[model samples]
Structures are given as C-alpha cells and as structure tokens.
Target: MLQAGMHAFILALGLILPLGVQNLFVFNQGAAQHRFRQALPAVITASICDTILIGLAVLGVSVFLLKIVWIKTIFLLAGVCFLLYMGYVMWKSKPAVSEDEERIFSPKKQIVFAMSVSLLNPHAIMDTVGVIGTSSMLYSDMEKYVFTAVCMVVSWIWFTALAIIGKITGMADKSGRLLGMLNKLSAFVMWGMAILMLLSLR
Candidate 1:
C-alpha cells in the first residue's frame, strides 16, 4: 500500500506540475481573489473534476483493460509511445504568460470556468485516462484502492497549493524561468515513467 501510494503521488505530481489551462486558471483565480479562502470555488471545482476523472479512469478503464490480454499489450505499448511524445511536447512547450483578469469573478463564474477548463480540455482528460488509468493496472485489491485514494488526495492538495502559490507569486512568471524548469523536470519524469512502464512488458 505504501509503495502504491508513493507511486501514485509521484505520477500525479509529475502530470500536474506542468503549466496548463487548468493550472493557469486556478493560479490566476488565486491571484485575482482578495484572499486565500476566496479562491475556494475554483480550487474545489477543479479538485472535484479531477476526482471524477481519476475515479472513472481507475474504475472504468483499468477494469476493462484487465480482461483483455492482447488489448493490454497494445495499451501498454501505446501508453509508452504517448508518454514519450508528451515528454517531448513538454520539453518544447513555452509557458503561457498572462495578466490576471481585471475584474474579480464571483464564485458562480469561477465554478463555471473551472468546470469548463477541467472537463473541456482534452489533454487533461488524456493524462487522467491514458496515463493514470492505464498505470493503475499494476496493482490489485488493497494496493489499487490505496493508489486511487492517493491520486485523489494529491489532486486536492495540489490545487490548494497552486492557489496558495498563485497568491504569493502574483500569477505571472515574467522571466518564464520557473515554469521552464518545471516543464523540463516534468518531461524527464514522464520519460522515466515511460521507461519503467516499458520494462513491465518484459
């Protein structure tokens, strides 16, 4: 269980650390809101969206993949290819630099926008379903449960932390150095994960 939890933690963190629409939205909200608590709507909405996606990926995707051996091989190979491609994309990606919106958003707008960014984004969905869901195949019974739980916990904690960081950093990475480093680090982690997953096929 401990190992499963740790694997889930690192994987989840690696996937989320990159700068994306979801991260930027939450970060901007945190910076725009007057107080930490004021950003709860965006934080909570994004967390809830992630929870739903992870649950579906683990429960729906993992179970189906488990039943088919041939498909499992194909899925594993495809996942490896994807992680490599994603790593390259991350390595070349430039972080978006945007000024915070001029007006304060009400909780309702925040919820709506959060839902849009969280659910409407294809890449985010792919990370949850393609990476996290397929990876959950490594364990069974209790370990799987721990893996799922840890993934969800990471999402909640990460969203909250992003908001806090946004408040402190004021949302814009003028130099892009911080986000550039994050992209590089995330790419390496993805590459390493790809290697580990490929080894499992042996």
Candidate 2:
C-alpha cells in the first residue's frame, strides 16, 4: 500500500492543477455554487463507477480492453479535444455571477448538469481509469482494491474541500480580482493537461 499512497499522491498532485483551478472557476461563477455542492453526489457516483472499472482492470480486464484498439485511440483523441475546449472555455469565460444572478440559478438543474459534466468528460476517464487503473499494477489484489478506494476518496475529499473553501472564503466574490486570476490559472492547467494527454498518446 506504500505504492498506493504514492500513486494517490501523484494523482492528487495532477488534480491540484486542473480540479483546483476549475473549482475556483465554479466558485466564482456563483451561478452554481450550491449546484456544484449538489454535484458531489454525481462526482462520487462517477468515482464509484470508476473504482469498479479499475478493480476489473486489475483483475485482467485490461486484456479484454487491450484487444480493442479503438478504445484507447478514441479516448486519447477525445481527451485531448476535451481539454483544449475546456481551456478555451476558461480563457473566454466571463465574471462570477452576482447575487441577483444566483437568485435565479436553480440548484436542482445545476446538480444534474454537474453530474452530466462529470460523466461525459473524457479527462475523468483518463484520470481515473487510465492513470489510477495503471497504478494498480504496482500492488497485489487486496492492495489494489484498497488503493482504488483511497483514490476515489481522495477525489471526493478534494472536490468537497474546493467547494467548501470557495463558499467560505468569499473568494468568489465578484469584487475580488483573485477570482479572475484563479480562472486564468485554470485555463493554463487545462492547456497543460491537454498537452500532457496528447504527448502521452504519442
């Protein structure tokens, strides 16, 4: 499990870039703070499904997965494109929603939208199934499961912390310049992740 901890550490490190900045953007938007929190249900939901898939991979599902050449290619291309689009979105995105805007934002719809975003996202697949799944190779059967669980929990903890911090710090307040800086940082990370994914494919 030592390796598992290391794996989690590394994955968490990557996440600090994209997820951290993205959370900051979400917080700033105020259009979806409550909705983002509601999205936790979806994030955890996706994490659980990913954990199951990872577990299967460690048990030799990779053999079956490997048989399909298109899967990897598809994901690689999709992930690269998705990251680029995310970069563009962050780069072009405007101000955090004001109180009046928040008043009109519906938490229920936001939660569903957040869930869809998590589910449809190619980056999530690469992170959880590709990275975390491969990391499982470093351990035994029992340890692999334990590691998967830890990784899933880490994702949940990270997102929850981001949401809570954004809400509490008033860091998303429209008046603050910090919010803009955070979004720019998010755009950079998105671009970085795109480049990294593209390189990994080659």
Which candidate ranks first by TM-score, i.e. highest? 1
Off by over 4 Å in 2: 1-53, 60-67, 100-147, 171-174
How much is the lDDT of residue 5 in candidate 1? 95
Model 1: lowest-lDDT 10 consecutive positions: 94-103
Count of clashing residue pairs in every prediction: 0, 0
lDDT string for model 1 (1-202, tens) is 9999999999999999987657866876676566789899999999999998899898775456445878766766766676676567657755444443444667997897678667654446656888889889899999999999999999999999999997776445566566666657657766776776678678
In model 1, pairs of residues that clash are none
Instruction: Give the winner by lDDT.
Output: 1
TM-score of each: 0.65, 0.60
Q: Candidates' lDDT values, in order?
A: 0.76, 0.56
Tell me the deviation in Å of residue 188 in model 2: 1.6
Provide the global lDDT of candidate 1 against the true structure: 0.76
